[model samples]
Target: MQKLLYLLILIFFSTVAVAQDEDRELLRGTVLYLNSVVTGENVINANTRKATITNNAGQFEMLVKKGDTLVFSAVNYKFKSVVVTQDILDKRRMVVEVKEKVTELDEVVVTPESKERFLELEKEKYKKYDYERDQYTRLQNYATNSGTFYNGINFVNIFNALRGKKKKDQRNNEPLKVSQFLREMYEDEFFVVDLGIPQEDIGKFLFFCDDKIKPADIAGENREFKLLEFLVDQSIAYKKIPKE
Candidate 1:
């Protein structure tokens, strides 16, 4: 009987809470809390396509009905959205957490090809037309006379090319900054295949390591060693976080 009474009481409170949430939906407007002072956050209503910008204080008031979708976007922050619920409308306030967006520039690799191979490819590109034709012969002669076909090597140019190549090779072989290195490693097959980290949590995991490892600390000859050490120390702690 006692257990039955306790169960009834629990159900009663749950029903009351749900009813209260429903009542909140009847309310007119909602006040949003911007966790950080994000200027110019665009708040858009999905249904109507209407938009509003958050004030400098990072707060916005939008009159929304239940089930209305609100999308929040900013230049440097990741976009977020919320569907208005009865409870949220009733409370007349919502707290929003926005993460700063990080953009990584694409890596460009410049490798010099052998001069002989380069010339061969260049000549072959123009060889689609029959060289026996008068027009083709004239075009080829003009190109050769104008130095367009020249691949002659100057000592100064060769020296600079070698020096540039050396620098490029050195940089390619150098240890990456800790955060970048971690980000790259996160995308590697080893992390997913071996460590079993999901792709979506890669960013979160990297952010968690910000305080633990500094960029300069990993920019040395022993970068791999330092990186391994940091990973070993933090992987356990990271795994402890409950998944949503």
Candidate 2:
């Protein structure tokens, strides 16, 4: 009878301790932009400072507790914070919508001369910068000068060439800078796991994508989605190439 009493006492204490413990649970959620998945965004627990990033499907999971504050942050998206509550904990899944930081101007007036000049610049790019070499000469010249870019123009790779090296060196290495930018932008798993390019072949696959379309062509514009789409297509093409 004493042993039975002691066992029940232990069980009661264990239940009390469990009931008093903090309600920490894994919360799963998707981030959406234009109703499409927004990958690579950050999900942070403001309380614990633990964090995780969204995957390709915009899904993310992180340990959150009741009353914990969750922070959502990413480039080109507005910063957001949410307070964890009983309902959120019970549901354990959420959908977060992030508003793009880009602002739409209500009205803009364009002068005829400016419009003509823009069109003229568009036409001049083909003749101005040699397309076959991907404008090596222009890039070399721009080593000390930040060149101008216009719409519908390709091969204006100012995003790369971070440091102004000597003209000869810049000319030789400027083209590879686009691939470098891409490499720095994403983790290796993006190429291997997400894109399905083999771990050893990431460099080769990036080069293949660069050759198809200069990933840096759309400078000063939101390029994440386009870059992801392009890489997906290129990865498909890359897998088809016969290996030695």
Candidate 3:
């Protein structure tokens, strides 16, 4: 009888162990936009390890075991990762909030005429400086023309030539400097737009500019002109107010 009781006790302990393991299993909560709508819906499941898209509102609920890692990702937003904790597991539901991404604009402008002139001068400078022989010429030229140029034709010409030569050399020889060389290494990347033109007229310019200009060109021109118009409109609106 004692042996029989011992066997039963062992069986009972085994069952309890299995139950504990099952309870400790991980769960995941995914947040996605439902039906492409911004309203979020969470799909909750504990037994399976899988990724589920959130509803349109970007909310999801899943059952996860302690120590399981949950990854949150969506288009245009930064990706995030969180490890499940005891507090999270204890909760009946978890709420994940995603913030909208904001893209900042650079205030500098680059005009088509200036771009052409800059490139032309850049080519001339490359030949003059012997950039093909001296690799450091490009880096040096970029450092010299790192800011806006509003006045003095001689300075602009000299600066642009050096910048162009350096940029060409870097593109041919070095791969790491390409992004910086394109963005900050040359002054030709930016153009200034003439703001005296009317906003209605600007639309016409865009249509004409399309054949000759790329998206980057449009953005540079539009951003500068829009900023100018916005400022002018604000000024005019304020002038109409009676002195207080």
Candidate 4:
């Protein structure tokens, strides 16, 4: 009889609890930023049956049932969702915090062939003009003012070529063509460099010879071409012939 009474009491409480749960009404709350800012109004609606946006004061209300999910969304912020339980439904109001999302753009790349072609055309158009000498002089001055990275041998040869001084010894010793030079540079450096500055900034002032030196033909040499590869990769210089 004692065991029977105990079982009866357990059954009665369970039924009462079920009845109470069924009688409970859904409650709604508005979503807002942690700072209490109202990003938008009326963003939430009923097909999202249990959701609604906050008003100007960042306040909103909705009907929610036990176990229903409420979602909040805005154009400027990431969407958020939370589940409503019996304890939460008892509250007169609820506040949800939303966070914003951020996006980043990819790096832009300029092609070496196009840049080289542009420089070549410019050089051809200006080669015989007196103005071209001034341009070359300015570039040489800039290079000289910058500390020498390789004993100035490369710049000396380049300057001589620009000045039309083709000493036989220098001709024989001319540093490899720009393409070859790039390949050599790349072989030595483990990383690449960006050389996408405007042609006027570096092109008119730097080496502009195209036919005199082609990169594609010289990339096959086994010597260190780290800097050369870096230049080619960065689009500062290009191989006239495509590498196989």
Candidate 5:
């Protein structure tokens, strides 16, 4: 009988201690939306397994505990998460500032002239070479200005010189290679749009791009898929950082 009594006392005291610990962990606090123009956001407590939406004033009361994770989500704003801490519980309030989701605008290209019209205008502005008329003019000049013609250098040399100049001009205006184009796309479009990364932080994310999967190396059809996969992987690493 004495042994049994001792066992019951131990069990009762153990249960009370557990209850007290639970009470200490429980935290009550108000979540405040920090947006000046918008209010009423959603708050979820993962640890307590409860959810609440803010009022029109951008505030909500909720119960949480130390180590509980909370998420704030809304249609008009970016999704955010916070981990409950003893400091927050002691303060009994938290101010959450969420950025609005960036809405992409439709692509609008403004041009001074249509391509076909511009090409046609260029052709009209510059005359094409007329071989027969040029030959007649050259013969006329040769007959009328014999002294000038004799003084001129060899015609073959002049022809070769003109051809070389044309070739050099064409080379200077060559189109960019696929590899070069891909590098521009990586900086301008891929990292910014797909990853939702800020312009300033793009340089940081670019370090993660592997040279093997460079845009030029990727097939045209697989460009989007490959870039998306790479961006997703980099995003995971980027999030591990406390601050960008």
Candidate 6:
């Protein structure tokens, strides 16, 4: 609902209303009860059905002619109406008012989306991003009750790697894109400080992180917290790798 300031019928005149149509002209207006501007209210002309909304400044412009009725409506505001008259047409600009209903926003429920679903969504959004070489990277996931989750090959990812046809579709830029996207989401501190993955080894560490879970799977989604959780847990397993 818009803010309410019980206002007297305010009739003001500015430059003549701009009538673009043979019969209609442009009418500028403001929706404010006091001196403060109201936001998010729709102002509509009932006769012509032309519409505009009160912006941050509570100002709007719409096409209008004499005898057209202007209606103001919003989620929290009581309906207010005014009619365009000859005097209003001469003025071109006017200020009006709306009364607010004492109410609150409706409740919203939030739930986490499945990682696979997020992956599918990102794939659709970045469909232009070619994923090349199903033959290149083998992947496996092993569930765990404690310590770091280890991805063990049980055969599925092996088949993926063996699929020769998948190689033809692989985009050469996907690996680079994956790294770039990760770098963009995470600051250097996340790699060097939080994960204890050195700046020099960050690139290799991301390669290691791709074994079980790839950030590319959910690239567009703003689920950085989920990525953070995965990275923290994955670093433990990464550290276990013997330094060459």
Measured by TM-score, the strongest candidate is 2
How does candidate 4 fare on TM-score?
0.30
lDDT of 6 by residue, 23-116 (tens): 6888899998545689988998888666889999999998888888999999877899999989999999999977765575653221112334
83 Cα displacement, candidate 2 (Å): 0.8
The per-prediction tally of clashing pairs is 1, 0, 32, 21, 0, 9
Error of 3 at 150 (Å): 29
Give the higher-lDDT candidate: 4 or 6: 6
By TM-score rank, best first, the candidates go: 2, 6, 5, 1, 4, 3
Writing each residue's lDDT as its tens digit, candidate 3 over 68-181 gives 666665554445666778887776455555443445464323322344443444345444644323432234433333443221122233345544666776556532221232
What 10-residue stretch in candidate 6 is worst by lDDT?
8-17
lDDT by residue for model 4 (1-244), tens: 9999999999998897667546546455656664566646444432333335577777776655666666777766777767776678778567677876444343222334455544444345434546324322344333334322231223443333433433555646564456333322222212222344343334331244344445444333231233234344444343332445
Model 6 alpha-carbon drift over 4 Å, by segment: 1-20, 104-244
Task: Report per-prediction Cα RMSD to one decimal.
Answer: 20.6, 15.2, 17.7, 18.5, 20.7, 17.6
Question: Which of the predicted structures, 4 or 5, would earn the higher TM-score when compared with the native?
Answer: 5
Q: Write down the lDDT of every candidate, Cα atoms only.
A: 0.54, 0.66, 0.43, 0.47, 0.53, 0.59
Name the runs in model 4 displaced over 4 angstroms: 1-28, 41-51, 105-244
Ranking, lDDT, top scorer first = 2, 6, 1, 5, 4, 3
TM-score per candidate: 0.31, 0.36, 0.27, 0.30, 0.32, 0.34
RMSD versus native structure for model 1? 20.6
In model 4, state the lDDT of residue 57: 75
TM-score comparison, 4 vs 6, better candidate: 6
Cα error, residue 49 of model 3, in Å, equals: 4.4
What TM value does model 1 have? 0.31
After TM-score superposition, what is the CA distance of residue 95 in candidate 4 from its true location, in Å? 1.2
lDDT of 1 at 67: 86
Model 5 segments more than 4 A misplaced: 1-37, 106-244
- What does the lDDT read for residue 91 in candidate 1? 82
